[model samples]
Target chain A: MAKQKEEKLHKIRKVTPGSVINYTLITLIALICLYPFLNVVAYSFSGYNAVLSNKVTFFPIDFTVSAYKEILGKASIWLSMRTTIIVTLVGTALSLTLTTVAAYVLSRPNLPGKRIMSTFMLFTMYVTGGMIPTFLVVKGVGLYDSLASLFLPVAVSVYNFIVMRTFIMGLPFDLEEAAKIDGASEMQILIKIIIPLSLPIIATIGLFYAVNYWNDYFNALIYIITPEKFTLQLRLRNLLFAGELNSAGANAEGIGTQVMTQSLKMATVVVSTVPILLVYPWLQKYFVKGVMAGSVKG
Target chain B: MKQTDDKNKAALRRTTWKQIRKCKWLYIMMIPVLAYFVVFRYAPIGGIVIAFKNYNVFKGIWASPWCGFATFQKIFANKNFWNAVRNTLTLNLLNLAVSFPITIIISLMLNEVLHLRFKKVTQSILYLPHFISWVVVAGIATNLFTQQGGTINNILNAMGHDSVPFLSDNGWWIFTYIICNVWKEVGWGTIIYLAALTGVDETLYEAAYLDGATKFQRLIYITLPSIKPVIVTMLILSISSMMSIGLDAPLLLGNSKVQDVSNVISTYTYQLGIQQAQYSESTAIGLFQSAINIIILLAADRIAKAMGEHGII
Candidate 1:
C-alpha cells in the first residue's frame, strides 16, 4: 500500500512539468489564432474616434454598431450577400449529388471498370492542366460569368470522392446483400438503406462542400466579370483592394477618414465571415472526423 | 496457336462486355462524373496543345498557327518569369522548412495534454482559421500589419520601437506571407498528425512506463518511431508538388511594393493570361509547371516505394 502510493505520487510529479509546458504552448497558440479575429471584431465595433486614436485592442473601445449598420444598409453588400447565398446553396447541392453518386458507384465491389474509374478520378488530383486551360474549358462549356461557373467545373473533388468511397466501402456487405435479396434495385438500396446509414458522412461531406463553395473567391474572380454577380469573398476582396470603405454621408474630417475606412473594412470582414462562423461550431466535430477519414485514404 | 490466342482474346472481350452490361445502372450513375472528368479535366489536358500555338480567339485552337517552341523561348527570355519561379521556390521551401515540422510538433504537444477539455477547446479554436477565407485572412493581416496605426505597429511604437513595414518591404512581406500561411494552416495541419498518433498502440506506452521509461524517453523512443511513417508520407506528398503554390495567399497578401517577392507561378499565369492576354506564353508556363510536377511526383513515389514505404501513387 505504501509502495502504490509512492508510485502514484511519482507518476503525478512526472506529469506536472510536461503538462504545464504543453498547456502553456497550446494556450498561446490558441490565443494567437483567436486574436486577429477578435481584433477585427473590436475594431469594427469601436467608436470612430477610439479607432482613430489607435486604442482598440482585445476589447472594443467605446462600443457601437454603427459600422455594421452602415454596411448592412449598402445595396452592393446586400447584392453580394445574396449572390453568395445562391452560389453556396446551389453549389453544395450539386457537388454533393455528383460526389455521392460517383462515390457510391465506385464503391461497389463488382462494378465493371471500378479500378479504371477510380484511377481516372485519382489521376486528376496529381496533374491538373493548370489554371488557364481549365478556364478555357469552363468558357467553352458556356458557364462563364454565371453562378454555375463557380461550382460546376469543379463539382466532384477526387479527395472527397475517395473519402466518401472509403466510408461506404466500410459498411457491411451483408446489408446490401440482404437488400438485394429483397429485390431492391441499386438506386433504391442507395437511397433507402445506404444513405440512411451514411447520414454522418453525408452531413460531414456536405459541410465540406458548403465551406468550399462559401469561401471560394478564385472561381468567382476568374470567371465572374460583372460587379453585381460577385460572391461575398470576391466582393470583400474588391472592397479591401480598392481601399475605399468610407461611408457615403458620414463625417469626412481629418483623421476620421482613415479610421472610418479602416473600421468599415473591419466591419466588412466581420460581415463576410459571420455566416461561416455561425455554422462552424455545429460542423466542427464532423470536420475533425472528415479530416481523419480523408487522411486514411490520403 | 495464333487462332487459339485470337479466340481467347475474343472470349475475354465478350466477358468484359457482358459484365459492363450487367452493371449498366452503375455506368448510368457514372455518366455525369465521366462527363465532368472529360470536359473539365481531360479536355483541358488536350487544351495544352495551345501552348505550342499562338492561340487566337478567331482562329480557335486547331486553326491557330503552331509556333514550334517559340512560346517556351519567350518565357525563358522574360526576367519576370524567372523572378516568379525563384519566388515560388523560395516561399515553398521556406514553408516546407518551417511550417511542416511545426505541424508535427504541435500535434505531439496536443497529444501530450492531460486534460481532454483543454485539448478539445484548443483544437476547436486552432481549426477556426483554416475555414476563414483568404480574403478575410488578408484583410485581418492588413489590419494588424499596416505601418500607419496598425495594431502591431501601434504596439511597437508604444514600446519605444520603430514601426515595421511588414507589408511594404520585400523581405518583411515574405516574412508576413509565411506568418499568415503558417498561422492559417498550422492547426489544421495537426489534424492529420493527431489522427496518425491515435493509431499508435497504447500498450507500448504502458510497457514503456513499466520499464521505467520517462515520459520524454517514451515520446522519443516509441511515439516518434511510430509516427515516422506518417511523417515520411506527408513529407513526400509535400515535396512532390514543390512547384505548385496556390495563388490566393500570394495574390491577396501582395501589393505593388513587394511584387518582386510575391509574384508566384499561379499569380504570374493569371496576370499574363487573363490581364495581359499573353495566352500562349501563359499556357506554356503552365505546361512547364505541370511537367515538372509530374516528374517530381513520379520520382517521389518511386523513391518512397524504393525506401519500402507504401507508394503514395
Candidate 2:
C-alpha cells in the first residue's frame, strides 16, 4: 500500500522550476495569439478620438458603438450577409449530400470498382488542371456570374470524402452485416443503420464545407461581377481594398465622418467573424477529430 | 488457343457483370459524383491544350489555333514571371522555416502542460484565428500593423522609437506576412503533432521517471523519437509542394509598392488570365507550375523511400 501510494504521488509529477518556466512560456504564447484580437475588439468599440489617438489597446477606451451603429445601419452589409448565409447553407447541403453518398457508397467492403473509383478520386488530389483551366471550365459550363459558381464547381472535397470514408469504414461490421441479413438494401442500410451512427462525422464534414464556403472570397471575386450578389467576404474585401471606405463613411448617417475608418473596418471584420466565433466553440472538439482523421491521409 | 482465350474473356466478363449487377444501387448513387469528377476535375485536364494554343473567348478550346511552344517561350522570357517564381520561393521557404519548427515546439509545450483546463483554453484561443477568414485577418492585420495611426506603430512612437512601416515596405511586408500566417496557423498546426504525441507510449515516460530522468530528458529520449515518423512525413509533404502557394494571402496583403516582392505565381496567373486576358500565356505558366510540382513531389517521394522513411506518395 505504501509503494502504490508512492507511485501515485510520483505519477502526479513535481512542480519543478523548469515546469514553472514552461507554463509561463506556454501561457505567454497563448496570450500572443490572443492580444491582436483583443486589440481589434478594443478598436472597434473605442471612441473615434481614442482610436485616432492610438490609445486603444487591451480594452475599449471611451467605449462607443457608433462604428457598429453606422456599419449595421448600412444596407450593403445586410445584403452581403444574406447572400453569404444563402451560399453557406445551400453549398453545405450540396457538399454534405454528395460527400455522404460518395463516402457511403465507396466504403462498402465488396463494392465492385471500389479501388478504381477511389484511385480516380485520389488522382485529382495530386494533379490539378490549374486555376486557368478550372476557370475556363466553370465559365464554359455557364456557371459564371451565378452564386452556384462559388460551390458547385468545388462541392466535394476529396479530403473530406476520404475522412468520412475512414469513419464509415471503421463502423462495426456486424451491425451492418446484421442489417443486410435482415433484408435491408444498401440504401436502407445506409439510411437506417449507418447515418444515425455517423452523425458526428457528418456534422464535422458539414462544418468543414460550410466554413470553406463562408471563407471563399476568391471564387466570388473571380466569378461574380454584380455588387448585389457579392458574398460577405467579397464585400468585405471591396470595403478594404476598394478604398471606397472614405466615401462610404461619409454617407453613413453622418456619424460615418465622426467614426474613424479604422473602427468602421474593424467593426465590419468583427461582425463577419462573429458567426465563426459563435460556431467554433461548440464545434471545436469535432474540428480536432476531423483534422486528426484527415492527417491519417486515408 | 484463340478459342480458349475468347472463352476465358467471356467468363471473366460474365463474373464482372454479375458483381457489378449485385452493387447496381451503389453505382447509381455514384453517378453524380462521377459526373462531377469528369466535368470539373478531368475535363479541365483536356483544357490544358489551351497552353499550346492561342486561346480566344470566341474561338473556344477546340477552335483555338495551335501556337506550339510559342506561349511557353513568351512566359519563359518574361522577367515578371521569373520574379514571381523567386518571390514565391522566398515566401514559401520563410513561411515553412518559421511555422515548421514553431509548430513542433508548441506541440511539445502543450504536451507538457499538466492542467487540462488551462491547456484547453489556450488551445481554443489559438485555434480561433484559423477559422477567421483571410479578409477578416487582413483587416485585423492592417489595424495592428499599418504605419499611419496603426496600433503597433503608435506604441513604438510612444516608446520614443521610429515607427516601422509594415505594409508599404517590401522587407517589412514579408515580415508582416510571416507573422500573420504564423499567428493564424501555429495553433492549428499543433493538432497533427499533438495527435502524434498522444500516440507515444506512457509507460516509457513512467519507466524513465523511475530511472530518475527529467521531463526534458523524457521528451528528448521518448517523445521525440515516437513522433519522428510524423515529423518526417510532414517535412516531406511540405517540401513536395514547395512550388505552390495560396493566392489569398499574397493578393490581399500586396499593394502597388510591394508588388515587386509579393507577386507570386498564383497572383501572377490571376492577373495575366483574368485581368489582362492573356489566356495562353497564363495557361502556360499554370502548366509550368503544375509540372514543377509533380516533379518535386515525385523526387521527394523517391528520396523519402530511399531513406527508409514512409513516403507520402
Query: Largest DockQ belongs to which candidate?
Result: 2
Docking class of 1: medium
Candidate 1 regions exceeding 4 Å error are: A1-15, A243-260, B1-16
- For candidate 2, the per-residue lDDT at B197 reads 89
- DockQ for each candidate? 0.49, 0.51
- Lowest-sum lDDT 10-residue window in model 2 chain A: A246-255
TM-score of 1: 0.94
Distance from true location, Cα of B215 in model 2, Å: 2.0
Candidate 1 residue-wise lDDT at A77:
93
Q: What's the distance in Å from true for residue B259, model 2?
A: 1.3
Model 2 superposed RMSD (Cα)? 3.4
Q: List the residue pairs that clash in candidate 2.
A: none
